[model samples]
Target: MQKEELYKGMNPLEAAVSGAALEGAVASGLSDPFGSLDLLTIQVTPLAIGIRADGNNFVPIIPRSTTMPAQKDLIFTTAHDNQAEALIIVYEGEGKKVEENHLLGYFKITGIPLAPKGVPEIRVILDIDASSVLRVLAGVLMPGSHQPVNPVMGVRMPTVDDGHGWCAEALNRAYGSTLDLVTVHKKI
Candidate 1:
């Protein structure tokens, strides 16, 4: 009831008692004090989103339960001598193994300058918009050029409906370590 109408048609003592009881209910968390219809709630991701690197390892980009509208980037190196490209296979979940995770999709960034293994820097970027749309971008810098090459290729996630495991296997078999990412370094 409106504040003006709450005490209407009631004795002064009755109105005061009723008001005190209502206040107690609210303060004690027995009732929602704000009865207005307008309310706002924040949303978060239910699972972690990430990519599969070499050795079937899952590298998390946006961790589980993180607030949406997020972006992250990770640096990786080619796993083979004179590697020409890097594959970015996106996945979702908390699993440590790539096969245990749900495959979203995959993209390849080609045209990497030929260099000894672990010499080139390949950057993988993940961006989640406010609407939960995901974007994968990969790029690299040439040995001599100062300008960075924009993503040679990209794809929206969750594009693979099934057979993702086979796809990953086939890619690994065909490319071996050429398109794989070098081992990630951990801080001591």
Candidate 2:
């Protein structure tokens, strides 16, 4: 019908975004997803996501409003001397402290070689795919070593869903900062 007129003076992408292509496809029993969604849509992060670090801080790996299908990593270290293990606690929100944000999930990184405080390198990675699924990965590496001592752990987020921050409060009261992590700041 009006298909010829819609394509008379427009490129495929322009026509698709102008709604003519989508309309024509529907009328002709065809399918086109981008026509309705448009070609310039960018999905941003809904909340700031990061891990708990020293002083119970929220060390952000992926800040809010970041595009989807993203992957980011950060370096952390032990808070105590001769620390053999550290807990990787993931949180999502804009709070500066871990307790102020919503607890997503947590995993304990064990088998850290006996070393002084801030001597080990603990790399934590966060990822969000096109489907909006979140995943976290962490591993331990000693100085001058490229390989991890233990197998990297990758887990989906929101392992704990107590929206009231009860989990964080309880965890802080019980384990405290004994298993906490400290951010490894990079020197400029």
Candidate 3:
């Protein structure tokens, strides 16, 4: 199935919360306080890589990989009397799974404030590399078609302004794209 099709009918926040709870259970070997493990079992219905956390615990799952370039959304909810935190790792470059595993970038969210003892969600999107894989798969699956050539570099830049002009500029040059800026000023 196509990667995009996986996450078409799911809520991002709900996905994140479920992902986090699953990972938390695996990583920490702890039971969920909310008694909602059933929801967490629903196959991650998104086409992206995600790591969810319940406090310090986490779990990693990717519905789509480099062969699939579908964006996915994830959510993680914290239990009462606790908070949530997470680290997401992305791997890029040419190599087998063993080799590529070492080359990765980490996105971390820390100290997510505690929600009232029910469920609060943290949402994120996962965009995979379907275009690249499509080319490769097409060539192999359908010979005489154009052979897929892996790009020299494949990376995604963050959309939010992280207060680094040079970094954004560099990213723009690399991707041949422009950034849209929205500035808000508050009067004291």
- Number of the top-ranking candidate, with lDDT as the measure: 2
Number of the top TM-score candidate: 2
Please write out the lDDT profile of model 2 over residues 59-154, one tens digit for every residue. 889999999989999899889999998888888899887767888888888899999999998999999998789999999999888999899989
Model 3: runs farther than 4 Å from truth?
A: 1-48, 52-61, 64-67, 79-85, 89-103, 129-188
CA lDDT of every candidate: 0.75, 0.84, 0.35
lDDT per residue for candidate 1 within 91-146, as digits (tens), equals 88899988788788887788887888887777677888877899888778655565
Which digits, one per residue and each the tens of the lDDT, describe model 3 over residues 1-188?
Answer: 65644546778998889878676675565766777553433232233333323322223334433344454444433333443433333333232331222222434444444444333334444454533331100001112324222211223533333343343344335532111111112221
User: How do these models rank on TM-score, best leading?
Assistant: 2, 1, 3
How much is the lDDT of residue 132 in candidate 1?
A: 85
**Who is ahead in TM-score, 1 or 3?**
1
Ordered list by lDDT, greatest first: 2, 1, 3
Q: What is the TM-score of each candidate against the true structure?
A: 0.71, 0.78, 0.29
**lDDT for predicted candidate 1 compared with the true structure:** 0.75
- Winner on lDDT between 1 and 2 is 2
Clashes of 2: 0
Tell me how far the alpha carbon of residue 91 in candidate 2 is from the true structure, in angstroms, after superposition: 0.7
Clashing pairs in 1: none
